[model samples]
Target chain A: MELTRRDAAAALAALGAGGAVGYAAHEWGSGGDDSPDAPDDGLATDEEVRDALVAVAEVVYPSAVSGIAAFVESFLAGRLEREDHGRGVRETVGELDELASEWYDGPVAELDPEDRDRLLREVGADVADENPEGTTAERVRYYVVNELLLALYASPRGGELVGIENPQGHPGGTDTYQRGTP
Target chain B: MSGPATNRARNRAVDRTPVDGADVCVIGAGPAGGLVAARLADAGYDVVVLDAGPRFDPGDRQERMERAIRPAYDRPDVWGVGGERDAHAATGEWFYPLNHARVKGVGGSTLHWQGMVMRLHEADFNSRSERGVGVDWPIDYADLRPYYAEAERELGVAGADDNPFGPPREEPYPMPAFPPSYSDSLFAAACEELGISMHSVGNARNSETYDGRSECVGYGTCQPVCPSGAKYDATVHVERAEQAGATVIDRAPVQYLEHSADAVRAAEYATPDGETHRQEAEAFVVACGGVETPRLLLLSESEEYPGGLANASGLVGKFFMDHLFAGTGGVLDEPTRQNHVGFITSESHQFYDEADAEVGPFKLEFFNYAGPSPVELALTGDDWGDALLERLNAEYGDHVAVGALVEQLPREDSYVALDPERTDHLDSPVPDVHWNVGDRALETIERANQVQEQILDELGAEVTWQAGPDSTGPAYHHMGTTRMGNDPEESVVDPQCRTHDLDNCWIAGSSVFPTGGAMNPTLTIAALALRVAEDIERSL
Candidate 1:
């Protein structure tokens, strides 16, 4: 069996742990005004983008990491400006906000880490198989969380944690090639 | 031996009409066309090669690495519809979503090809006679053995070629393969622990610096782009063809062929600016992949042959094939320490020959994709914040992945024809693929699953991901659309890849493959191209 997030969480839940352990694996995909998502009307304001990054970053990344919010916001905003997928990403985060409001009666940024984790897990798993037809959280995993995590680890700061030390394109010293493969 | 020219020069591409005279016109500046154009031009025959997409170079090693390591453009501007002008794969029912994977450029899909180059097993050639499945190729493995040897030298292949699993070769590979990483070594031991035979296969990538290219630098990204130029892309050969007096025109989408009296007279290409350009040549070879080849043939419908050009057998776009692929991944308790390194190391044909008469043979390729990237892991699973980061920090590279390519027998129904409604920007009809795997392929996939399980289980892996039957991702080898056979009545092209309808029009690349074995088709495609070029030269 593949150790999915739900699997690990369920394992933790079985251990009677607290603080995001017992997430409600509710039957999801409800709520919202029932109109189709807008075709990416550019990114939201800087504050909105920053809030979205901080909310997800607080849930997905390690705590006490300085400048985490700044790193994520710049990465997210920069991608939105460039790639076409960035527009979809911006829309997905807005969807996450919608789902967060429905589930917790508040925004993702305001919700405690536990509630945020719960909503993300429930929404994320619901849309795991196939998507564009799910609650905001479910699709947010695809659009926002997916890109967020990608931006985090594929960067130099993220690479340092995993022993990559100097990410290839981080504008470093003379040698750039990683002599790892044949 | 018979591929790249030693001349280093720029490939001056024509932007629009009034094309330069050429002895031959080859459509698609890909592996086959690039090599053929180079070979002809080397022999002093003026050649013109046309590609639909713009020519995008990966630049020098460091720059290429920079692009690969960056985001959005992380995969080079070679994939998808709008980003880099690659085709939107016309998918059919039950076929995998293939549009975002294949690239379009002067180097063609070779720019994005994973450099796994292995010859078809001898048994693969006689499947019709021996296995009682699929049509027998008009030519055998022995017929193309010399050309395969030549392609290896030209492409700078490195491997231990004296394997019992492989077909007979005239000589050893040009260089020994790169050493396997520690994780790969563990995977090999696990395979051995389960009594499975494992060996390294020939890779087109350089093990040590040879020719003008550098060695592999382990960027872990070979599919989208190869940084060090160690893995051979067709642009260098296309440039060589240019140096030898051949011309490659960018954005010249070949819409149709202009033929008369059972011979192709001139080729018509739609320029980017909505203008048509006529290029006449002594001979015409369409190497624009399997789908594009048939699409072009069908789009070039004439009054004499209303159905399609050179489609006299009505098999021009039939029997389209892709190898049955099943991927498996698992995580280990201990870090492999050799994660993120990206050389394709060991391959096992231990389970290649199936005893079950219901299924075709399959080859399981082992890869050291031991790192599922901390970000991917964090994004997935039920971990959040410190939990996610802590988990990621501990187990980044402690992962392993292995996959198998089951031999898919040619089925008549799985085909590629011109979509009746759809057309490209050039107003040429796009390919409509009707492809799917059957019960035989499923059985092969199940067997592959068992092999994957046997290895992972022995290693005491905690978790695994094997989308066995759900694996529909294409292996990217487009073949058998313009299949080769002895009878003109049954096949689109003859054994020498000459269309029965047109004497001067020949087909090149994997498009002419009668059967696609469980190995990557680039080298085989290269071999066929070299052989066809030689034949074309002799004829000229």
Candidate 2:
């Protein structure tokens, strides 16, 4: 119930961000090339970013959820292609890793599930207001948490999980509309 | 000092080579211009249509639809409506978003319009006699009755004879009506409880493939873009005109009309290649919509008629009018299945012709796309997994909304004139729209909101938003700039839609509307364009 309250507050923050940005629907991770991980300019390598996100997803996602690593990896490929968004995402991941090293004596990917969740809470991401150009916790909520949620809800598979058989942009034909939900 | 004669001399000094001389020259390639061109071409006349915008590829609709669906993409950018070329000045009480409301391409604003079509009631024609407010149209509903039927058939309207308040029609709609959306059915129960009547809305979109286009597959982004070709746009008529031997020159914006005291000799226009050319014709038709039609007339000042081309009465850009939208939305306790349909399937015209009502008429619309989209619900949530699912289910389908188009009376204060300060890409003065919601319109909006609130209350919904008098905005139904009248001293155009001052120039489209009713103007526009085409044929 407490998580639900926090989630509602976070949802409003994410909505604000979503309103400011335009999103397009396409095959996840289909367009971008999969080059080998090459970290540059103090940003995290793609592999390190994927590892850390998967660890975060393990704690953030529900216990029934499966394929957390694969989903995060695929979604990241597409997100990393957009220049400004990709740089912000990389910086957020790098900040998370720094916080992880300082708190848990290692990288975020190497932390236990409970420890990773605790690390997120410790950084005040769960309570801080989400802002793209604010504090580290706000940036984490803006670039990291909202990005994951957007990818999940925008996808057809994730949409079905939330009773959205056919999302707004998808063409589900006239029959789906003519018949009411049973 | 520079005068009309000096401007004419300066224009003549430029390379004004004549091109595409025809029997009739249509200035715009919008619904009115396209319809006129098609009819004149079919009647075996050499017609040439000059459009200010590029001809959009039908195949690129899917990409445009993507732009509309994506939250990050701007709506204006999706239709290519920006840059110096489309700039205009809005020095009104409220900022009039002209560029967002109009598209300048081959199909014009129809390219992005929600395809609702309705006929003006008999009372709408005789507003002066019936309502004691706005002036009566020179021509009545009886005169346009046959043309309305023809326009419906030409535009391929899908509807049912269910609206009791509608004017009498001789023929059924071209196609059967679209079934009511799930949300409309929900509203029906609440409306029935309150003793209000609901009827199917007539749409230009196909119900079951009427004119070579496919039936509605419900892509659901019908306003800004319809990926499927089921929805009708003015491009349909433009293509029909082209097939009937009408030559259409795209990206050709007419700068000014070259004329003497009696008739227009030619239209001087600029192409994409930065060259000016003259289109000489036997008769000239300015089929641009309300705003641009008057702007064009004002821009075409000459030594013969210095005030403006057809401004001997000084009424070219006067009596401007638009319909204002009053909307009320809320969330019901149960699922309404909102956003299932892109367009409205049901509406109420019960209050449209209210007997002896002081306020102007208003038509209620039941919105099918009222709630947040799935993507919107998803992004706004803070929960990642199971908790997020609960929130999405609770919020997605319960939202409902009611909207009304309130009639606006033509006023002296609200008119379109050329802005002295702002110039468009071609260095021509841009249209300055001076508009304000009058006392009658404000009263109508309040009445409409009250009606909507009653419906929402009957539904036992939690009221979230209501657009009151101050919040009500234009429905983008521009009308009554070059209003039609019999007297030459009072109005710009005659009963035949001919400019009172110019012998050979005719005006078509909503600019000639004496009074704007609460219905969509496109069907009436098409009918009047067909009539203009017939008149031009008779004259030649």
Candidate 3:
């Protein structure tokens, strides 16, 4: 099912995007490398970040899930507007691209779906304990994998996939709660 | 309307500028204060009510509900609780999370409460006479029965006359009870097998539109915020009081009460714009819940009454009480449809009046929001795609739980006192709650859990979790601080809720409860507040 930008924005707001963004900024500020090999501004362009997130969403979300690219793109628009979250996303994408360049001789956004999935596994993001400030793997899981999942599930369309017609924040009336599933 | 103002300011110069003296000045705009102010105002008595917190706009409830639903928004921050303003000290075996459990705004804690309204059983008032433990209240069930009906109607309670264990009522509830949730239906057979009878819980949330409020449209975030004005909050009565021509001031925390040998002269309060104002009245009512009511009295220490204002017995803050919770939950083989209902529908009070048992009384609750919500299950899972969908379907439903509120006896050791070292933003000693769970309470919790396990076993469910006796915590129903009694030396207030030491000054709320039965205290708080209003009116 198709999800709109409004659904994605509501999802982001429910997940406390501002708090997550602040945590991301704090994590990146304290632990991020200041190497010359990094981007000149220590941030990637919005297009680059969007491309990388959509690529990662392809691997993280269910294969049955449709319109992932549009959903992730819509989700990113709201997320990237926040300066702190934008910089955190940009830096995270830059790090992923650096690793892709070293391992696959290409950027993550250009890799095949299977290769992109393998890249996340190889970076230990699939196995790492999800933390905002622990390690590269943990940061990837916190900012990339979890962020996408939270956005998806918090949305009404995504919630429908699991039979949650009305998530907690949404105003599902009394009749909705009174009976069993039809 | 100005009265004599004395030199009662502790740290700063007292502002003699009178902030509208009335016939009755009610402190704390909670359920108790709201009811008193409304009744007095309607009776043609001039009333002024002062609240320590902001008057939240009802329009902001949607955003507040969102804040409650979101994981990152701190729960206390949802009601604007925390900081130095709400700071309190806890010296108990179990950490009394006061800030998390209370709201100080115009609506008070009812703004975030679960809206369960149950009257104390007949035996609750005669615990010493019937059960051989705890002190008997000066007034019994018969005394408050009419007021309970009035309170139920006033708060627009939705309930049925189904509880055989409940005290006798002369009238039906204002509205019919909400039908049991789907999960409650699932537990019916198991409960039947165990011979544990379940009945509808009386709730302030509207089943149908009553008293101009909307019917509960199940926003599901009832604890911290109800976006719809379906659930009854004290703001309802506060507004009613205002409509009846009572002056209600918010963000005006009373610092101290200046009292003479026989009566309270005035209440010195601090306003938002950095000014102190004294309010004098023919009668004064302190309805600031259990903790703050005693703290305020203790803060009102005078040279005439060295212990505190109307604290001749030195029992102003003693005998503090709170009901402890016992919870048990498991996964049933069939779908239970958990997390659909935010408030409870089914409860068993059969064990609430066990006179022969050594353990204290307890009321069993069937939890509707027992299991994890869809968002919680989705966010925590490690799987993705069809695997994630499989996990969600497998784990989302098929969960059920039962909780019980066990009675805690009022002990002299468990008290609310002024924390000498820590002061609040008002530059007065914050309330120090010294609470300790006794052996009887622990025994009661164990017994309650056993009964819960029996029902779960009858369902052939795998027990996922159980709150053992040691794991028990309070249900946040603060009571019995300024206990009411016939003797002035033992209790702070008399049977009429008037201070034994002062003729005109009165105390309202659960602070005057001699013994808190294992029920939600708000209903009784309302009943007592209504009664206190009558007492104040008669005296005036």
Candidate 4:
């Protein structure tokens, strides 16, 4: 239960073993970016991304199951080739990993549950100050975490999945009634 | 019976005969040709107006169908160019190409425009006055204001009295302001917190049924074509002229404006079926938008007026203007999303009037709303890898977007000329546009960004990454090509919208606007058309 920098680092280092636990490390560490059509070399893979998403979602919303991870993985996979778009997420994930090593001395997925929650709480303010200069990743990471929670807990589908009352009101479909380029 | 009845009968007999004839004939339509044709027809002359654009009818199916099927490039929808390279024009709507300029069939480009009318601020009229930047407008805003009011009632705009920015006017708007949408309230609340004032944009759309048109339905699709008759386009004016016994021909494109010694004698148009028609008139008017109007004049060079008719100043195809737009979006702590449908609900004009306090200000207006769908939002991303998409969907709702329209100073450098190489499907030379932002233009944008950031913070919204520091795109408010001016040396058209070199020819649309103020350009375009309409009436 005592999560520390050494524990997270050891867990991340053992990811290449190709087992259930190793799958998380493989997914988070080497996002499957190897493709002839791949626009970039550092993109994440479905399996590896799924593993990491599941790990993050558990800490973000502990009660959810395999759903959020699948959603995030599929969504990310679909945007691999869109220029001016994919860079934000890539930068954010890369920055997240870097911050994990700085704060916890290890991979983010290896942190204990209590420490993981603490990291999430502090990230809101900390990520805002990261600046990222020429990249959009840090901003993407900050945005994505807040959005995932809002969607998972506040959306209609999310409402049916879990019991968090979406206080934002009018789940979906209504706001989209006549929206077009104005 | 002996005096009045006999005179009427004689007038009718004369009308029965072809009153006037010209070499090149323009058909009846909207603002594009209507304004020009009317002026020519009134000049003790013979100009034929063959307009076939959809006539405004309250809930008329034939009108709707006509607007829907009119091809902009005059091609079938299935033949449209597709893919990411042309995604901005993904679906060519019924009447015209999405943004190709013109409503196709008739009244030209003004058929479905929301008449949010305001002249370019004085600085806009004279970019060179204070900034010493950009070319001076052939005409100033003060000169255009009288005409702006004349055009206001002609098009019937809805606005409040005494505008917060710029010069004072004699008459108030015909109708009150259009109601603010739910999004407007939210944005207003945020603006208030940031000490910025938001105003209801003056729209040419009828707030409550005026000038024989029905009230507005706030239909989201105001561009391309409006299903509601609330919008005052050129078609209405064309219809009025036709009702007064003007003959309108449809499906004909004027190819040339034949001029002789500073007088346009005729306009030549090619019919859709490939027939050349010649009608002779005493005078001619060129109401085509900035690009096409000048193009026709240039294309019609004869032995008489070389280097294009009415090109004595050599300024016909110069000074093209389109307001630059950049979008900013972020998430708010409170849920203020409502009435997501409607055109612009509110505008931040607080910065508009005070734009050029020191070196002379330029116009900048702030507009925003919720966000587009996931498919559309994908276009806003900077990264293209797999991880990017996932993050996008995950972060969709945590944001609201603000679009800032920055007015550019009129410069000869930013012009729309015939491209040396690029041609349209019709083998005609496509317009090659070169628009660049100067140091002052960039300064206006930076100031807009600062205002946006302050407003976002006041709205209790969390900031996201800003999209525009260097990137700028056309907001589709094209203006200033055949500009009106005091001196004929620098302008193609005179203050009354008459060609400086051509005594009988007149021009309309944003082409006459010297500077592009931050407000939408359509209203001013409509106003100018109306002012020219009054001038045409007087000369007769």
Candidate 5:
């Protein structure tokens, strides 16, 4: 999948259905803020980036779980609220959308399901080739999918996928060590 | 030696009419101050202990952890430096950064301590005699042995007495050792296979209630806060000091000591509100940790004592030292599932005698880490979505961080001095420190790193995170700022930790440590404080 300047829409329909959070599209990647002086506003809201992420999450966390758009939007909004590197993250999300739009000839958030999957696989292959060690992709996918997975997997609902008895940092009894192997 | 029992540690105000009955004044109610103050008051001395930080109730452990971990406000400003709203100084420029590694409060730094309590080895006391580097401690391990035992009992240390590498002890730990964490069992099996012996570290956490405190509820946030009093914090002794008739005052940072020709007459302290109060005492014990103790002495400059109150030998704030801290370890195939028991569950002193004076000795606080934090998960981890979750599930907790806390030789160049220009809220000089990882320590760190790798390899783990010599930072084991020795010219305190320059002043903490071995420093600090209180009681 050598797809780099390449890489999001089922995300918007879901957002329109969920109305999880508000946003202005294209705030992050547009700032070109991968510098020390970059504002810690990497999580600034971007409708287009949010839409792209939901589409990516759909491909990433495939299931009949219909709220990918709302989850991604809520997670990005929280990042903008808490972390300094957030605005840069929002920027990367915008970049991801640009790549997807360029490749598919349509907004990623507005793409057909099969096209969205194909675009994600191509981006994944390119990210793997470019960042064999994985750090660059982590940054590239910070707002798009990776961080969303962390927030999701660390939740009681999502933690069920792993053998995790309790979400990390939560106060739970020790005797409840995971009963079965994943 | 008795009067109205007051606990200004929370919000109780001191009467303006300089409270007169206090026979001894102890500053900084941390592990050092708490033990000494309690001992003195128990001996019926009418002690008055002053802590610059606010008195934190153990009940607020959850709230404090929430506030402490945030980017905006860390733990409450127990350092007497500033409040939560005030931004902390960027200390990255310093030789070593404390960066929330130390805390200030009624319990002092113990509020943030992980409680890996252990006594310095017998060989640690006479390092100069054994290896010929730093000055030897004026007193030997024999002198502190009884105090160490008593301290373990008083603080409720839990562990077996069978660590082959541990120094001979008079008694077993006050409580049976905490059940080994899952990581401990795996690491122990690994060490056994490699012909290396591992010991459960003597922890100040409780197994069952010996004191009025409850057993461990196992919330797993033991570093800065323990929701259950299962883990020991110095605040327990602050209340005990009050019960023993000592007046415990909080937010009272001692500004200076009033002294006559060769004796300290009273301690002058400032309230957070800018009000000043003086407590007259027969003698004064400075138990402020390594940093603030020297800061206090250096700030107390007078015409007679030009260098500082305890600087007749010009050695009040020299020979500062901290553990030579660095991490060396690897990632394993299966999760160790460690965080359940506690941080620093086990350590070994097998390498304590490996080097003579030319290189520092060290101990390994060994355990499987809880694994890469949420941030690390995203950065270095592969895949996304379901694959991401699958990868994290497989690799997240499968890691260990064998951090070595190596002994440091005291050098005069690395010291704590008052900044000439910078001042705190009370206009007292802010402490400016210069720390250099000694060239000798580099040799020790290299060997320690090698040992760390050996452990990881023995555990059949693949090496991942390796910290080089330059990456070593503070371990919070502050010591030797006010070096203790027999010679007045070469040391600040005598064998009893009293200032050689002054008759009625003394110190109680690792600040008086002449040569710090690779122990955690809390047990030894508490032992020394108890010893100092004994001496002060005799003088009284």
Candidate 6:
């Protein structure tokens, strides 16, 4: 039948029980959050991406129960390796981490939730202004955030958490679905 | 000298059946062919659609991309016969030669299309009355409005209920337009500030489920193929036709139409394995797109009609048209580019209907996406490495772009003929497309650009760069090769899409577009196909 969050979680659990997962299939923007380039254990296992993810995810989505940082980190790192000629979404992620580090001496996870929220707003503005002399920071941030939004709104688990419907009959419909100010 | 068997003797025949034997034979399977096959089959006709290419799947995107990059875009790959010139071949990501005219298996080129579905403005029909140029259409906007509505429903367009400048319609759109992407939002805000009214673009992309399909995933991969069935493609219609009873013969390249007494009797084709086959029918419909339709007519020349059947007007492949597009981008004060993912969610047609004495009124479609790929972005800007990347990170959020797609009024001089030296598979002549924009076209573009520059300035975007020469590339909206007219002397097909002088022969697709408007062509193509199908059913 149609794939759901429970099925994906069960798949994730099975993979966890079996040790590391392999890059068998990827439903990054939908049903499954499996990374095409990940080691397959679970999510965001890349060190550089983990650090960046910890910084930004903690700021934007700090429910802790949501596990937003780990999920986003895994998604970003996976997409970075495969997209845009392997340079990665490094600049945008790096900007987030550097900002978080500047604001808090310790890891972003150690920051108080209030400060984390404030840091997210601050970093959002910073990344949005990244560069203009060449490609422009606004363009870079747009690309990165757009990818991130896709990961959040398009993935199965993300869809469940956000109350979005299953994209049955066509999995690519999420791209065309009109979203409110979420 | 050459009766049916004698003509058969000239080339080793595949199906040696004489004239008037088969049920239905469809020539070419692009948008029109695909849709016709599906509809006729659904209506209980034993339709046999002949296409030149093989079918494709979305998973084959990489292979498709490789082919596109290595050969298709830069050379004479897809045009069939000699096909059109390679000047406008470099459309990024959506480039594929074999599938250009009539994609092989199912969806046709809708598999690889950007789902823009705009209805032609009212002025599109009566060009002479409005623009003081081009011939007025045999049909008017009112005549086509019902078909437009039907086509929109069938195609599942996502557009606003209000279309102030468009033709009056029966009902509102089935679903609302797609929301504004961040880039679109920025442009909207900027345009609003500039007193330019922006509306969400009417896209063929499904906003909500209508038929048995799902919505779009906003993958930005509108070209090549939509693995997801969110976008409307002709294959979907073709598939529907197959389920109903149409027999699609993939890889059957139609060579020419076989006719007698001005009635199409059969279609000659080369199978994938090189066997020549002829499928005879009581009636023949040629839906081989603009370039191929004309090529087929030219190749099917008989002594009775030396200049080509229905080409007594000498206009079988005359008056080709394409929307010429130019893009200009600048940095706005707001964080516009950071959210490039949904860029192009909205547009402003304010400039489209405004009165202008010299060039007439032209249309403008503002882009909602971040400008270019990283490599392209790098080339556009003078920076590299972390610094360059850093700049991309910052400025992507502040960029707003406006792209203009202007209608190049039809001129008979702009035409597609077979190139003598260039031969393609099946030994067909290459389509020698010779199109040079007239003075009015240039003036139209300049006026649009001037307005866009003003809008960007008003939005406080420091205009950085514009993409185009004094002129721009003829856009992907290819149209009007074998246009329809009231008189047989001036056109290849009649208003019913039946070939003039050839009673049982018919044609379809944008090739039948009498006048190319500034709007995207898919909606119009769909409407025309629907209209032609009705006529065919009536004829039956």
DockQ of the candidate models in sequence: 0.11, 0.26, 0.28, 0.02, 0.10, 0.06
Instruction: Chain B TM-score per candidate, please.
Output: 0.92, 0.95, 0.95, 0.78, 0.91, 0.86
Query: Highest DockQ among the candidates is held by which one?
Result: 3
**How many angstroms is residue B319 displaced in model 3 relative to the true structure, after the best TM-score fit?**
1.0
Which ten contiguous residues of candidate 6 chain B have the minimum total lDDT?
Answer: B85-94
Q: Per-prediction count of colliding residue pairs?
A: 6, 7, 1, 55, 18, 59
Provide candidate 6's TM-score on chain A. 0.49
Say which prediction, candidate 1 or candidate 6, comes out ahead on lDDT.
1
Worst 10 residues of 5 chain B by lDDT: B1-10
TM-score of each: 0.76, 0.82, 0.84, 0.62, 0.75, 0.70
lDDT of each residue in B151-180, candidate 5, tens digit only: 898889888876898778877789987655
Instruction: Give the per-residue lDDT of model 5 (tens digit) for A6-37.
Output: 00122121111112322333234333244345
Ranking by TM-score: 3, 2, 1, 5, 6, 4
Write candidate 6's Cα lDDT for B377-486 as tens digits: 32233332234445534543455677888878778777767666766666676556666556777777777788778878877788887755364765656678788888
Candidate 3 docking category? acceptable
Kindly list the interface RMSD, in angstroms, of each predicted candidate in the order they appear.
10.9, 5.8, 3.9, 16.6, 8.5, 12.7
lDDT of 2 at B276: 90
TM-score of model number 4, chain B? 0.78
Across residues B1-540, which tens digit of lDDT does each residue of candidate 4 receive? 023465455534432222354422443355645654554444433446653232333333212322232211121221122222112211111111334444444655555454556655655665566655556665566766776786677778887754466467787788887655545666667777676666666677777889888776533335545555677777676666555455666545566665678677656655534555555665455665655666667677788767777888888767776666655667765443322323554665567655562322433333333553332232233332233345544644434667677776667776656655655434455554555545666677777777777777777777775646476556656678787778888887877887888765667677777667676776567666666656665664
Against the true structure, candidate 5 reaches a TM-score of 0.75
By lDDT, rank the candidates, best first.
3, 2, 1, 5, 6, 4
* Top candidate, metric TM-score: 3
Residue range B1-540, candidate 2, lDDT tens digits: 123475456545533344455999999999999999999998898988888887776755755664565443567867889889888888889678887888888999999999999999999999999999888999999999999999999898999999999999998999999888888888889999999999999999999987899898766778887767788889888999989998888778899999999899999899765899889999999988999999999999988778789999888888888999999999987777766558889999999998234699999999988878776555443465567667777778788999999998988888999999999999999999898768888898989999999999999989999988978788888899999999999899998899999889999899999889899999999999889989999999
Per-model lDDT: 0.69, 0.80, 0.82, 0.52, 0.68, 0.59
**Model 1, residue B301: displacement in angstroms?**
1.1
Among incorrect, acceptable, medium and high, the docking class of model 6 is incorrect
lDDT of 4 at A180: 25
- Report the lDDT of model 5 for residue B9: 32
The CA-based lDDT of model 2 is what? 0.80
**Where does model 5 exceed 4 Å of error?**
A1-161, A166-168, A173-182, B1-17, B67-94, B373-391
| A1-182 per-residue lDDT for model 3 (tens digits) | 66666666666554434333422232222212343455476465667777888898888777767777777876776666455555667777778888998999988899998899899888877766555556877777766776687678666667677666556655556665557764
The CAPRI category of model 2 is acceptable
Q: Model 4: how far is B365 from its true place, Å?
A: 4.8
